[model samples]
Target: MESNVSELVERLGSDEDAVRKMAVFKLQGSIGDPSFADIFIAEGGLARLRYLTLHASGNTLAYSLTSFARLLEVDKGWDIIDQEVIQRVVELIVTHPLVNILRGAMSILVSIVSHPYTGNNLSQGKDFGFPALKPAVAVYPQFLEMLVNRLSSADHALCANALQLINSLMRESIANESDMQWPKFIQKLQDLGVIRAVYSLMQETALQDHMHPLIEFQSLTKVLLRKWRGIPLDLENPEHRRALKGIHLASLHERRSQDICIGTGTGTPNSKKHNPMKWRRLGFETESPIMQFEHTGFLGMMDLADYVRNHQDEFQKMLLEQSGKSGHQCCPIARASLSVTLILYEHFEVDKSEMDDSKSYLLLESRSNLDKLFEPLILHWTRLHIAGLHAFFRLWKATGAESEDYERIVELVRILIESVVGGAVRTKDVQEVEEEMASFEYSRLRGLQMELLELTYEDVWGQHLMQMREELYHEALQFIKEQRIRCLLQGAWFPSETSLNLGLGYEKVSWTYAQLSHNRRYLHFGGFDAIKKGRPELDALPEKIDLSLVSSVVSNVSASNDPLLPNEKDIPPASYTKITIHGHLYPVSTTGDTQKNDGQNGTLSKSAQEVVLLSLHPPSPSVASEWLDGLLMLLNQQPITAKTNKLLNLVSNYGLKIRLLNVRFNDVAFTAEAPPVPPRDDLDNDYYYDVFGGT
Candidate 1:
């Protein structure tokens, strides 16, 4: 065997191309045998393979990668490699046009990354056999970009390979047990769009099969949730740095103890601290799979995994519904749909021990005699968990309880509502309701509230339920109020529209309702029309004011009481107020229509380029301060970037071109003038000459 391996290695350097190909092919065949692998590496086979990777093409390049990657089975192989070699391999995997070569390169990466020692050394902040692979942070950007690109491939094998590669990368990175690198890895995934791209895989039909890809997806998600649940490290802050260092030292000591021989260890004073295996469990005693699943909400993920494995048709329908019928109840199929949702929430950390209590608490709260009938299923249902809550509600509704159970059911419903509202905490784990999950949460909560209202409508003992409903309403109202105030204080108000005018009272238009909203590029005030026309519709379309055109938002102003209109210089003191936008001053006053602006009324000129003042009168001085502060905060947003302005300008020109084409096609008016451009300091710049691809 030794003589044969030597002959093969020597042929790899043959003068003829055919001999070289046969020699490389034979070496590839010997890579699986550890003895043959050892001999090949010991005889400087790696240097020759590395040379081929740099200079060879096509099948020769593929065979070289295959033989070289398999030889990395030994620790001695990692010792001899460098960053240039690893980078060359990754570049080949990323840039190679042929699918077979890409697959071969990806397989090599998956094998080496799966090795336990690779992860162990990387996590300890030691060399990963190469400088590029050492930090992980430095090379992750390119690595993640290439991985995300492959996820969009239509070929099943290619997509599976990409998913498996991602799974291996995350597993090795997380296994390092080092707290400092953990959060950084997760953050990099987020920054480079890899996390979001991976999430898009949930909708992919081909990748959801009961294969290695699915298992890898589930495991990668679990590791992500665990990292999110842990405290973040801030190296800039001294106190945070100290905490991270303490955690690092503790983890290091734990790793060392696990390596020590068992029972040979002394019954030391710090036995608990020294026993790394014991501390690793973090108080989770049993080795039961269910208990293990409970820690990471893995059970919910398993439920989803089962659905994807055994019920492909049902899963496809659920995906379609999530895309088209978002915010509507998942009726008729609510049970099946909620099962998948349960998995998503579990993986996302919406269901946790801290927020959830046992179902025994629910049983103790209910006083109905019919409780025995529901007890069996109720026992299996988890409370304060979103999926369990929705499932139990649907089941109870479907069961058609007796009339006597109404009061008790109403009480239970009250308990559910309060639990959901009270349990809401500022957690990164509880994912915000996106377009898909919208119907699963708030809408269901509203349904529960309505159920309570209907049950308590007219019964003698219903007074308590009615009061609870009222309290819940007030709680909801207060929540919205607080959220609004918080948005105001935080300066992150959602872009919105409001009715307004210039407050300069015109003859035909005593009041004009206008809409307002702000984006990064401009402060827009549009939707202008007459108030007395009684239609409550805008007479003219809205327009946007570029932020670059505006100077400031101010309140100190004097205005004229002219009914027709007033110029900026004609306004007098004490009888009027106004706001200045883009050097255009318009008077402000309360509108007579008490229904709008919280009963505060006024209107100025409805003409273009005028400041539209919002007349809001709160019920109290504090409310007034909140309204003012919120407005000021919204107005104080940072200046728009040049890139954003350029985009807005291009979009504006495209719309103009579209409207011009429409007019020409209809022959409505070939002479119709284009709308005047808004005044801007940078309007003279050549920013939009390429709107039609190019001039």
Candidate 2:
């Protein structure tokens, strides 16, 4: 097979076009196999293919591009492709006249820039070996502009391809904000007028007729607008100043005034000059109302908030109509449009006084749309439910305490919360419920609930609502805690350390299941077989440690310095966590026999002060770090406050570390030096309180 792949590679240098084309096709077929791919690349197949893409014409050109696309589909194939090759491909996409050639070129670009994996792997606390590649085509100066221009293409397929390519580039750029290229890439997209183009395309009757592409464009445009949303208006920049002026003008146009006739006590006409005397009149007097209007002048210069506001009715009608559509066919488009609407509402600063007059309209429309979302049938879809939840929060915040519909909004929120948590609790008996809880849908729901709780805690009305439904609120919190723990336990395998004296004659190393007891006061561990057989009894376990007796939990140890347990190469050093327990020791037999002797029984012994070190190896560093934080929480005996629970939940959900700074509660404080805490969307900026600090 290697010889066959090598022979085809050598044929790429043939003088006959037909022979080279056939060789490229054959190589494309063979490159799917990693071994064959290595042989082809070793024979300089990449360089040969690049040459054909640039110099060859017609069938050879198209075939070579298709082959490159196929090669990129292989695992880690982007590592072998160079930036120069990516640039040439972009050039072909721009200059090539053939649609097939253009399609093939776009496919290669998509393969290069798309995320390497699917779903929220990072949120799940898992790591992929391959980092997502940056959108190399952004380096080509005209590629983004070309893509924007292609949005108006007569060919639907070409336009769809352009949207996909643009979406992939934007997604990759946004996902890796640390990359220096993101700002420049975003500015380039904005400068090309991509957002306006997308909005215009969305309004087109033709595009709206096709559901999939319209949703894609809507989602892409929403992402593009994110960087510009809520950005402080720079009065120094003429464009920003103009945007402000346009907003003022639009407000004036929407404003209304009325004059009322009033009877005067004196029968005399009022003078227009100052210090005029009032006159009494038996009849009524008429007065002219002041009115003002100005030209908005070039909608392109206006900010997105004002732009959406200018067409508020049109956008509202469109979104409301789209939200009304039912079935799987329309769910995605509805979700995308709702997300876009959410961003617009957020930017509109709906909580401020300026939006007070329009609050009724916003609330009424949001409530009506939410009626569809809260339906028993529609609530089953998690994505749609999330969108509805977000929209509900925004409307609830905007409505404040003044609207007549405030109570109704509160009722809808309760329903949404119950719908999310109750559904999960009811599914606990299902076989796949554990897997379902670990899914991205539930993770997103959990994060949303945390944000809701925080919002409720801060607002006066929200506080009242919480008091009214305190039980439901606590249930929501418990649901979050359980789901977080479940996610942490997924794929977590702790191997017992060899150095510990388990009364076994020989060193024993095996996988064990570790979990918090039913009341969460004790940590228990038993053989993996018991857990696999669906019986994980805490009291029946051979080894149980009271969390209150735990002194400290240390991780990332290469070797144990304790004189009692010698350092050994029984487990990987990076994943090891050394747990120090004081006061009592519970030693269990390492043998597989289930018979419990008095010494091996899971019982607390009344012994003198003793320090025992137990080392465990988790699946990864993040998991080890999570276990460390959880144990520290237990050791401190700190009650789980809303803030602390949120922090722990963040650690479990996003795999971030909680660096306990100064934590103060009831005039007591605990401080620790650790790495800087990662920024979270839900945290307040006034002070970065330690998550371990009890509220």
Which structure among the candidates has the greatest lDDT? Answer: 2
Model 2 agreement with the true structure over 482-577: per-residue lDDT tens digits: 544443333245655542444565544556667777666666766653125554555666777776555556544324332323455553333334
Q: How far off is residue 608 in model 2, in Å?
A: 99
Candidate 1's C-alpha lDDT? 0.45
lDDT (Cα, tens digit) per residue for candidate 1, span 162-230 = 778777777777766654475576556556665545545543433333145644454455445544434
For each candidate, what TM-score against the reference?
Answer: 0.36, 0.34
Count of clashes, each model: 13, 6
Q: What is the lDDT of candidate 2?
A: 0.49
lDDT of 2 at 688: 52
Off by over 4 Å in 1: 42-44, 73-76, 111-126, 129-141, 177-181, 199-202, 208-210, 232-695
